[model samples]
Target chain A: MATITYREAVVRALAEEMDRDSDVIFFGEDVGKAGGVFKVTPGLYERFGPARVRDTPISENAIVGAGVGAAVTGLRPVIELMFADFAAVTLDQIVNQAAKMRYMSGGQIKVPLTIRAAQGGGAGFASQHSQCCETWFMHAPGLKVVVPSNPADVLGLLKSAIRDDNPVVFLEHKVQYTEKGEVPDHTEHVVPLGVANIVRRGDAVTIVATQRMIGVAQQAADELSGEGITCEIIDPRTLVPLDMATIIRSVQKTGHLVTVEEAVHAGGWGSEVATRVTDEAIWSLEGPVVRVTLGAGIIPFSEPLEHHLIPHKARVIAAVKRTLAV
Target chain B: MSEPLSAAMRQQMLQRMIEIREIEGRIQELFLENVIRGTTHLCDGQEAVSVGMAAVVDAAHGDTVTCTYRGHGHALALGLTMRSMVAEMMGKVSGCCKGKGGSMHLTDMPNGLIGTFAVVGAGLPVTNGAALTAQTKGTGALALGIFGDGTPNIGAWHEAVNLAAVWKLPSIFLCENNLYGEYSPYADTAPVENVADRACAYGIPGVIVDGQDAEAVYAAVKTAADRARAGDGPTLIEAKTYRYRGHSRTDPAAYRPEGELDAWLQRDPINILAARMIADGQITQAAVDGLKAQAATDAQAAIDWALAQPHPPLDAVHEDIWV
Candidate 1:
C-alpha cells in the first residue's frame, strides 16, 4: 500500500487513464498550465501535450458541450468546471444535452464524457463559488453522480468513470484534495459505479454520508463510540445508480438510519435516500430517517456563518443520537 | 468545386428540396388532423439553406450537423429518411430516435444528423466538440451548427463561437436568419442588421448569402468547408431565409407586415433554384413539375409507412437511459 493525498490520487488516476486510452482528453479553464483552480490536475499538460490537455476559455456551456460533442463523435473528453456551482451556467448543456444525448438519440450516440468539478462548502468563496450541487446531477436521469471521500476511492472511482460508456458528473470536494490516506498499490484499481462502501461496520445507527461528510460522519462515529454507540457508516459513492440495496441492508441490520450531506435540506439527495428507505425498508426503521444537512438560505461569505450551515460532527452526532431516543 | 455543378446534381438538389417541402407540408396536415402530439416547428421556406449546406457536408467523412427545433429540413438534408423522421414526429418506435426525439429532436447519427436541439444555441457548443475531436485526432471530418437568428442573442451562442475561434476547430456555423426569434422579429430582438455581423467579434470570417438561392449557399458552404478541412478555422455563414409557417403549432404569424410573405414568396427557395437550373438548360419546367409530383408521392409513401409503425413499447422508455 502507498500513502497519497486525494489531489495526488486524482492526478494519478487521470494520468493512468490518459496513458491507457489515447481517446481520453482533459480540458478546463487553467486546468492545463495552472493544473486546476484547486490544483487537482497538475503536470497533465507536460505529459499529454497541448492537444489532449487543453486550457479552455471561461465558457462552461462550451466546456460541457464540447465534452458531449467529442464523446458522441470520438474522443472521451473529461472536462472541468473550476467549481460545481458553475454547473448552473451550463445546466441546459449538462442536464439537457450531455445527459440526454445518448437516450434522446435512441442509442445511436453515446456520450462517454466525465465532468469533474469541486463541490461542497468549505472554501469560504460564498454561494457562487462554494456550493455542493450534487442534487442537480443526481436528479438528472442519464448522469452518473460519483463523489468519492478518500484518496483511494478518488483514484479508483475516477478511473472507472473515465472508462464507463455514460456521462458521469464526478464531484470532488476541494476540502478532500489535501487530505491524505493510504491507497492500495494496485496497478489498475477501479471502484465500479453504483456500489456503496461500508466504511465503518457498527450495529448502532447507520450514518450514510459522502465526500466531506464521510469524514464528519467518521468523527461523529468515533465520538459516539466512547458512549457505546456503534455507528455503521455507508458512503454511497454514486447517486444516480444508487446502491439502495447496501443502504437497505444496513438499515435492516441496524434498524436505524441517519443521512448527513453538505447540500441544503429541501429537495436534497438525502431527502431522496430517506424516501427510498421509507418505501423499501420502513419495517426495519427503528426511528424516523433523520437528515443532517445544510441550513436554509444561501451560504454566506463569513466563515463562522458558513460553518453553522454546514453539517459538522456535532449535528451528525445529534442526528444519530436522535434515532436512539426513538 | 473545380468544375461547375452537373445537371444530375442540380436535379438531385431540387428533388431533395421538394421532398423536404412535401414532408413539411404533410406534417402540417397531420398536426391539423391531430395525428401528431405536441408542437412542431416546420422549415417550409428555409429548405435551400439546409440542402445547399448539406451539399458540401460529406456525411461519410464523419461530418455531423446539429440543428434547431425547426429541423425536419436539416434532418432530411443530412440524409435521414423521410420515413424515420415522420415516424419520430408521429412518435413511432421505428423513428430516427425511436420516438423519444419527436419533431424537435430528430437524430440520425450514421448519416451525420447529430441531433436537433429544442433549445436555442444549444447545438453550437456541442458541434464545436465534434470539431475538437477532428482537431485532436487529425480527422478531416467537421461539425456543423444549423441554428436560427434567435441563437445569436442567447448566452450559448457567444460561448460556443468564442471557444471555436480560439481553438480554430473544424466547425461550420450556419445561421438561418429567418428574421424571427420565436414570436419576436429580428429588428425587435437583435441589434445587428445581419446575423453574419456577429461573427466579426470572434475574428472569424462571416459571409452572408441569399438563402433563397441554393447555388449561392452551396458555394458559400464549400469555401467554408475547404477552409475548415484544411485546418484553417471555423466560418459563420448567415443565410437570409424565411419560414412560410409560423413559429410552432397552430399560429398564423399575423405579426408579419402586409406583403412581407408575398415579397418572400416572390423569391421562394424552390422557385429560385428551379429558375437557375431552367436558365442554364440543366432542367426543364416539365422535369421540375415531375420532380414535385414525385416528392409528394414519396412523402405519402413515407407517411403511410410511418403510420403502420407501432408505438414505442412501454418498457422501451426505461431502456437507452444508460447506454
Candidate 2:
C-alpha cells in the first residue's frame, strides 16, 4: 500500500498501461516535455519516447481524432484535452466519429479510445477551463463516462477504462489532483464500471457525488457526524452506464439525498441523479432532494466569483443541512 | 476508341459512371414513378472524379474512404457491390446497411469503405480521423475523402486539413469541383479560383488536375498517395470537372445559363477519353461497343440480384447501437 495523490495515481495508471501493452500510446498538448498541464502524465514522455508519448499542436480536433483513428486501426490511444471545455472544438470528431463508428459500421470497427479531460472549478481559472461537461458525454450514447473521486478509484478505473474495448470519456477533477489518499499495492487492481462504492456508511442522508464533489461530500459527512447526521457518500465511477440501483437503494435507506457536481446547476449530472432518485425512489424521501452545484451564471474570471461558481464544502454542508431540515 | 483503355479498364470506368448516372437517373425516374422513397442526389456530370481517384488506392491495405451526399460514384468506385447498393437504396434487408442507411448512407466495410454521410462538411473530419488511425497504427494505409468545392468554406474542412497537415496524416482530400453548391454557383460561394490553392495555407502541396480525364486524376492522386506513404503529409487536389446532371434527381438546373451546359457537354470526360483511345489505336470500334454491351449485361444482372435479396428483419434495427 502506498500513499499517492490523485494526480500521481493517474500518472501511475497511464505508465502501467503503457508498459503492459505495446499498442498503448499517449498524446495531447503539453503532454510531452511538460508532463501535461496538471502533471497527470508526468515522466511518460521520457519513458515512452516521442512516438508513443507525443506532444501535438493546440488542435483539439486532431488530438481526439488521432486517438479515434489510432484506436480503430489497432493502437489504444489515451488522448488528453487540456480542459473539459476544449472538447467542444472536437465534437465533430468525438461525437460524430469516435462515439458512433462502432455502430455506424454495423460492428465492423471498434474504437478502443480513451479521452481524458480535466474538470472542476477552483484556482480562478474562470469559465473556459473549469466546466464539468460530463453530462454532455453521459447524454451521448456509445460512450463510457468515468469520473474517479479518489486516488485508488482513479488508478483502478483508469486501468479499466484503458482496457475497455469501447470509447471512454475519463474525467479528472482539477481540484482533486493534489488530494492525497492510499491506493491498493497491487498493480493489477481494477474497479468494474457501473458499480457505486459506499465510501462511508450512514443512515441519515445519502450524499452522491462525482470527481471533486466526492471529496466535498466526504468533508460534509465528517462535519455532519457531530450533529448526529450520519451521511453516506456514494462515488459513481462511471456515469454513462450509471449504477442507478445503488443510488436508489441508498436513498431508500436514508430517506433524504444531496447530490453535488462542479458543473452549472442546470442540466448537470446533479440534475440527472436527482431525476433518477425522484423517478425510482421518491416515496422513500422524507424531504426534497438537495443539489449543490455551480452557480447558473457564466464562470467569472474574478477569484471570488469563480469560487462562488463552484460548490465548496460549505455549500455541500449547507445542502446537507437543508435536506435534513425538519 | 483510340486512347489506352485496351477495352477493359476503360470499359469498367464507363460502367461505374453509368451505374452512378443511371442510379441517380433511376432514382429520379423511380421517385417520379413513386417506387423509390426519400431525397435523391445525382452525380451525372462529375463521375470521373470518384471513379478516377479510387484507381490509386488498393483495398488490401485496409484503406478507408469517405464521401458526401453526392456519393453514388464514390460508393461504386470503392468497390461496393452494385446489387447491395441498389438494395440499400430500395430499403431491403440485403442492402449494404440492411436498409437503415438509405441512398445517402451507402457503405461497404469489407471493401475498406468507411461509409458516407449526408452532412455537407462532415466527411472531412471523419476522413481525417481515419487517416489519423492509419498513421498511428503503423498501417501504411491511406484515407481518401471526396467532397465538393463548397466544403472548403466549412469550419470542419479547415480543421480537418490543418490537423492532417500538422500530423502528417496519410490522407487525400479530393475536391470534386463541379462548380455548384445547390442553387448557388461556385463563383458566388468560393472566394478563390481553385480549391487546391488553399492547400498552401496549411503548408501542404496542392494539385489542380483535369477532373474529366480519368488518367489525369489517377496520376495526380497517385502522387499524393506516394507523398503520404513517404511521410510527406496530405495533399489537396482540385478536380475541375462538370456534372452532367442536376444536383439532385428532381433539379431542372434552372439556375444554369443556356450555353453553359453545351460548353461542358462538349468537354465530356468520357467522350474525350474515348476519342483519345481510338486516335491512339488503343481500342477498336467493335471492342468499345462490346464493352458497353458487357456493362449493360452486368448492370442488369446486379438489378436481378438486388431484386431477389430478402428484406432485413425488423429486429435488426435495434442491433449495432454500440460495440
lDDT of 2 by residue, B1-323 (tens): 12343456766676676566555555567567655678778787777787788887777886888888888778888888777877787778878877767788776777767777677767676677677667766788898888888889887788779888987989899999998888789989888888999998999999999998887887888889999978789999999998776777668888988899899988877666667667777766776667666656676676677778777787887667566
Model 2 residue B286 CA deviation (Å) reads 6.2
DockQ of 1: 0.89
lDDT of 2 by residue, A99-121 (tens): 77666555667888899999867
lDDT by residue for model 1 (A1-326), tens: 99999999999999999999999999999999999878888999999999999999999999999999999998999999889998999999999998888888888989999999998787788989888898998878999999999999999999999999999999999888889998888759999999999999999898999999998999999999999999999999988789999999999999999999898889988898899999999999988789998857688999999988898999998998888892
Q: Pick the candidate with the highest TM-score.
A: 1
True contacts kept of each: 0.88, 0.36
Q: Give the TM-score of candidate 2.
A: 0.92
State which candidate has the highest lDDT: 1
i-RMSD of all predictions: 0.7, 2.4
Off by over 4 Å in 2: B1-7, B32-35, B249-251, B279-314
Predicted candidate 1: interface RMSD?
0.7
